[model samples]
Each structure stands twice: as C-alpha cells, then as structure tokens.
Target chain A: MSGTDDNAIVAARNFVASLPHCRALGMVVEAAGDGVATLSMPYSEALIGDPGTGVIHGGAISALMDTSGGVAVLSHSTGAAMTATMDLRIDYMRAAEPGGRITARAHCRHVTRSVAFVRAEAFDEMPGSGPVAVANGAFALERATDP
Target chain B: MKRPEPIQVVKQRRDAALRALMNGVPYIRFLGIAFDRRGDELTGVLHYDEKLIGNPGLPALHGGATAAFLEVTATMTLCWATLWDDLEAGRIDVATLSASQPTRLPKTIDFTVDYLRSGLPRDAYARARVNRSGRRYASVHVEGWQDNRDRLFAQATGHFLMPPRA
Candidate 1:
C-alpha cells in the first residue's frame, strides 16, 4: 500500500471511531481499503429477537449493514466528510445464529458528486454456508471543499 | 378476556397495552421508544440520547437507530390495530394481552428504508400505516419526522409475518 492509501485507511478508522452508535452496538472496524470496508458486531443478549430460538433480531442485521455502507463511503472518498444514508433495502436470507459474531462487508460500487451507492452482505462465518442478509444502499455525501 | 367497558376505560387499557409493548420488546425497549395514542392512531417517539449519535462530527442520530425506530413503529401499529379489531368483535380484551402474547410481535420478512435527511440530534416521531394485511402477511408503510411531519427524515416499507390466531 502506498502512503496515500495508508492515510485514507487511517482516516476511515478515525471516522469509524467517532460513531457513538457503532460503539453502542459493539461494532468494530475490521478492515478498510479503497471503496471497501468490513465491520463486525459481537453477539449480545440485547440483540436477541426470539427467546426460544436465541436468534438475533432482523433489526440488528439492518443496523450492521447500514453502518457498513456508511463506512464504505468513507473508504471511497478522498477526504472524509459528512455522509448520511439516503436509502437502504435489506433482504433477510436466514436467521443469524446466536453467540456468533456477525460480519458485514460493503463495497462502494458507485459514487457521484452527491450520492454513493453501496452493496453489502452479512454473515456469521464467511467461507461457510452463505450470507445471512444482503443489502443495497445509497448515501448522500456532503463533501468538504478542497483547500 | 373479552369484556366491554366504557370508552375511556377501554382507551386506558389500550394505552397500557402499548406501554407494555414498549417495555417488553428487548430491542425497542432498549431504544426507549414510547407510543403516543390518540383514539385509534399511534405514533412512536424515540427520545434523543447521547448513545444514539452515529456521526459525532455531524452529531446526528444513527441511521440504524432511525431504521429500527421505523420498523418497530410499523410492527407496533399493526399489533395495535389487531387489538382494536379484536375489541370491536368483543372476542378478546386488549387490557389482558401481555408482551408474551403470540400476536404481539410481527416478524419482519422484508424492510426498505429511505432516509431523506440526516437524523439530527432530537426526538424522532414515527407513524405507520398498514397498507395491506392478510391471513399470513402484512405490508406497512412507516414515516419518521423530527421537527416537521411534512418534511420527514425517513420513510420505510416492510412486510411482516402474521402468525395464525389462537
């Protein structure tokens, strides 16, 4: 990796560190590269949807995907600025297993002057069965003027 | 649990039921969302907490929080409507229903959310409309607003699985 790529990764890390909800949800930044980002959410009792099944709630998966999408925007941008989710469509493929960390990987597929599009997937264990959920999202970017 | 009482008394019962919903759902209750009941209409309110901030630089509420709020609002609205339907039929009492009731939670099958604006640091309100409900599934539209209802911060549509009645 070049110095420029290194700086962008650091910037992305800083931006992720500043998200209060990410910390509250116990989400961590695993890796970030050009137009790509990965995030993980640890298992928590607070995220359980069914007591009998011990399955994680679908809402928790939605949160993970949305946050991963936002992080992808940071990875793709030259300078991190304010970006908010414009829209997101999530499809639940299967119920996430309890007591396993959920990992979300997002790719910033496209970015224009005002909007960035992201595609993401979440899974408990990758290279295993398949994704638990898939998402497509658009985010609005508020870019800072270059000096 | 089917009993007909005064309208005011019934309203109180329904309100208590809604309150119990807010307290029972581990996730919705975790976010501290409360319901405001007006006759047959219900609105969900999510009070701003420091923990809800997603972007410290923007000081905005998390997008996930907004989505979750809207989703919860949609399900709660459906459950509320079911309670009224049961009450009108005089078959089930709304006041007697608990969170553990089978029909209390509507499992989300699909969800789509559109965020029109940043979720600024403030109390957010959401209202849901049951677009179509059948025996096994229900579709709902939910809108979230902060300062102005006309200018919504986000809108969502979802399909939920409806369990068979007991």
Candidate 2:
C-alpha cells in the first residue's frame, strides 16, 4: 500500500509487468520492497493439469516461484537492476488447490559480489495446508557499472 | 485388435502415441508444446509466441516457460518409454490409447534448473535423458536450445515419482 520509494521497486514492478510469461500466467505483484517480493496468480481453467481434478500444474507453480525469486533478487539494494537466474531448485510439497489463487513469496537471503540467493514459497490460499512448492535459487546480478 | 509386427506397429503409430501422451496433461496443451519423435527419442518443441517472452526489453523467453518446457520434456520422455514398451509388448493400440481416459503423469518430487543464457525469441527445443528409471522412481535431465543445439540456454534435472503402473 505504499508508493515506489526507490528505483529498485520500480524496476522490479516494470520487470514483472513486461514479462510476457508473467502476463500469460496472470501473475500480479502483491507486495515488493526491501529484498522481498510477493506475487499472486489467480486460478483459471487454462492452468489446470489434471482435467479430472482441475488442479493447477506443477510446472505453472514452477514458473511462479522462479519469477518471484527473480523479482526479489532484483528488488534488493545491491546496485543491480538486472538479474538472471543462475540456478533454481524447486520441491513440490503438495498439489495446489483447485480454483484457488496461488501466492508466491520470495526473500533475498544474501548477496555476494556477483550472485544473489533467494528462497520462495507458493501458497494456494487454503488454510491448514502448507506451501504447494518451495524453491531455492541463485541469480547472477549485473550492475550498470559491472565490467 | 489385429496382430501386426510389433516394430512395424509402433513405428506406424508413434506420433499418435505421443499425441495421446500430451493429451493426458492439460498444461502441456495449454502451453502449446508439441513433440518430435524419432524411434524412442523425443524432442519437445515450444514454438515462438509473444506470450512466452519474459524479458520484453531483451525479447527473451520467460525462465518459467523454459523451465516448464524442460520439465515437460523430462516427464514425457519417461512416460514415452513406458508407452513404447507397452506397444512393443502388444498391450495397447493407438485407438484405445487415444480414446482412453487420460493416463497418469509422473509427479515431480524435486527439480533443479540451470539457466545458462537468456532464451532468444524463437522456437526452442528440448530433449530429456532418463538417467535412472525404476518401478516407482525416475530421474531425468533435460536441455533446451534454440537456433543451435550445441549452445544450450537452459538445462534441468528432475526426480519424479512414477505413478503406479496399470
């Protein structure tokens, strides 16, 4: 509920919006600032994996966590406006509930000279059930002054 | 129902079998992913679409799309092995397979993806190698490339829990 106070948040918001895959998956930035970013994707029939159960696909959640982690890394105050995922590891804890909005929250755990570490989780807006998936990632940070 | 040479039958309907496999998962279809089959090998194709671009400034494909494509390749390769074996054993046919309810798909226990380069704005292809496959477990490594096969943009290793065999 706060306006952009820094270039990092603005860049992260623009990055998320301009991403075609984010639009394709209906990802929205719920909150972003201070080395943390949260995104939500509304459920749709097009995202279903099993037509029988109408559960969202694991691959879609994979996309969500990856982007969320990337956003968190980019939003950090590390003087890096651009970041590329070096590697990401995702574990599926459970299938996302059908017809439920899925939210992915990511925190930048640390930043090295050239890499940022991120951890992300996806929740399907269902109480009691834990995260649908969790992701650990490392991203290559590129500052404007990087040689 | 009619008997035919196993090799000949599998060769005759390999594409149909692949199509049937894709039909099993709605997400694969939603992503517009298709398969290219040669004997037992499969190459997953993600054709160029404006919706797949993650970095519009660079005009690059989304990392999530790339990951999904690789993951689908990994799991489908494992699933295809089963379908191939079943076909060779004369346990299934194209018609029955296609008409049957969507079969089970492997469940991903964990997956790790390495993005080596930005995915260019074009069609990308991936092929998965099953590192290990048992009755209940499978491990696969998949690589995605565009324009040139030697220059890979992304690769993934995944462990999947195989669905119980019917």
Cα RMSD to the true fold for all candidates: 3.0, 2.5
DockQ in order: 0.63, 0.78
Q: On residues B1-166, what C-alpha lDDT tens digit does candidate 1 reach at each position?
A: 9566788877777676677656556777667788888888999999889878887876788888888899889988997787676665657665455544533467788899998888989999999999999888999999999999899999999998885677
- Which digits, one per residue and each the tens of the lDDT, describe model 2 over residues B50-103? 998888888888888888899989988988986787876768877877785776
Model 2's chain B yields a TM-score of: 0.91
Off by over 4 Å in 2: A1-11, B1-9
Model 2's CAPRI class?
medium
Query: Candidate 1, A81: how far from true, in Å?
Result: 3.1
Q: Write down the DockQ of candidate 2.
A: 0.78
Error of 1 at A41 (Å): 0.8
Off by over 4 Å in 1: A2-9, A77-80, B1-4, B88-90, B93-96, B99-104
